[model samples]
Target: MAESPKRDTRDTTPDPKGRTQDRLIEHSYDGIQEYDNPMPRWWLTTFALTIIFSVLYVLNIGPIGAGKGWIADYEADMKAFAAAHPAPSGNDVSEGALLALVGDQKALAAGKSTFDAYCASCHRQDGGGLIGPSLVDNYWLHGGKITDIYKTVVDGVLAKGMPPWGKSLKPEQLTAVVAYVVSMHGSNPPNPKAPQGELVTP
Candidate 1:
């Protein structure tokens, strides 16, 4: 067989050390030139997070790092939120303003949400007020009325260490809670608290 030609092995490209692969811009006064290299993924993520935190920090502060009654503002906002959200009375809003909140499915749902959050601690999941009063029945310990229950929840009995919730909860939320109580009268649940006060038969 005839001998085959060998490929050229000699290096022809100049040793352009530190030069960009795409070649530097034609003009260069100082020692700066834009690169064609794509930005790294990690760098992009870091920048995005920095922007997000800046926005969050600004919302919680007034200026110069001062919170400026941030807590009070937060509490007020929460109250407004509760009122606007209004407990779902299952769209069953009936009766006058006081009793209107009661018997409504939506209002009951809202009441259930709030009751579980705060009352459940003292009063078991059932209407039985643990360390509190049994809510399963008509208990007149504090006159039972959509208004009475609402007032008690808001004003709270200082003697019982039940601090006023008016500052913590919106009026509508309180109404929803009372609505739930009214709905629970005479209902059965697991391990219901002993019947207390006047057995309010709904």
Candidate 2:
């Protein structure tokens, strides 16, 4: 008996689903085949829109004006804020201004708290000299004037082992702490360490 030849199974025209199965012959692996399918209309439209949006965004055109990027807007806002709230001035940190705060019990308390947190380790809790110089004594490593104290606290005497507090403390806090140190004068705490600098009246 004669055997019949097998017919080819590959489609040569568009399928019922509208896929051009004839021209879409992808490489076969094992016994499986693939079709070169077209993407959905909605997906293609979205992809094109995204590309357009990227170009527009980079160019800053149409609805997006030039120099209107997020970073530019942020910088503008920061500049305006800085202009509105300027940095503190010398008068703001003056001795008289700080002394006035001494009269405010609240300010003294705040200053004491700040000193304890930062200065107490070296100066001791009672303002008696330890690793750092005493605040209660008439003598000072630096000048004892209110302005001098303010500068010392802000600039710090690095050579003498004190770190500058200017960056760490706010303007008001610096003034308050200086005021508190001034208030401690003549307190004469126990175990008072020997004075190290010129005598200046409080």
Candidate 3:
């Protein structure tokens, strides 16, 4: 018996639309065959757009093509926020204001609550020092003046592991805590840490 003639699978012929007709691939397995069809125009366009977008994204380029990039954009946003809501500064509160709070029982109670929640872990409940220096002692690491203490609390000693509470705490809480610390001066809490800084008269 003669072998069957091979089927024509060439894609050279053009269709009525003047586009090459998709032809079946020559090889087949179990009588299964497939055509070499080009992807749809819309799909190809979408794929190309995705590639362009990926390149722009990798370069941190903004929508306008010419921009400061994502990092700069983020920094600008942060600066705007800071300008709109400035961090509490030492100058914002006066020493007399803080001293007045020191004598206020309600303010002192609030301060003690805040201190227990945030500061007790480092300074101990009695302000005798733990990881941080003693608050009850005459020696001051940053300063002894009430205003100086306010600055320290607002700015924080990052090198010494104290966080700037000005950003986290309310303005009232900051002043209250400072007042509470002032009241702790000369407290002579038991087992106080050795004086870390120069002695300052209370």
Model 2: residues with Cα > 4 Å off, grouped in runs? 1-91
Task: Find the candidate with the highest TM-score and give its number.
Answer: 3
Cα lDDT of model 3 by residue, 57-173, tens digit: 778877536557777788999999889867876544877778889999999999999999989999999999999999998899888999999889888899999998887999889
Please tell me which predicted candidate would have the highest lDDT against the true structure: 3
Each prediction's whole-model lDDT (CA): 0.69, 0.81, 0.86
The TM-score of predicted model 2 comes to 0.55
List the pairs of residues colliding in candidate 1: 88-106, 88-107, 89-104, 89-105, 89-106, 89-107, 90-105, 90-106, 123-130, 138-200
- Model 1, span 1-202: residue lDDT tens: 6534533343334566844344333333355545345578899999998898677666764442544456657788889988985543433333366476665788788889998998888777787667887777666677776667766777788897787777677767777887787777777777766666664444
The order of the candidates by lDDT, greatest first, is 3, 2, 1
Candidate order (TM-score): 3, 2, 1
RMSD of each predicted structure: 15.5, 10.9, 7.4
State the local distance difference test value for candidate 3. Answer: 0.86
201: Cα error in model 2, Å? 2.8
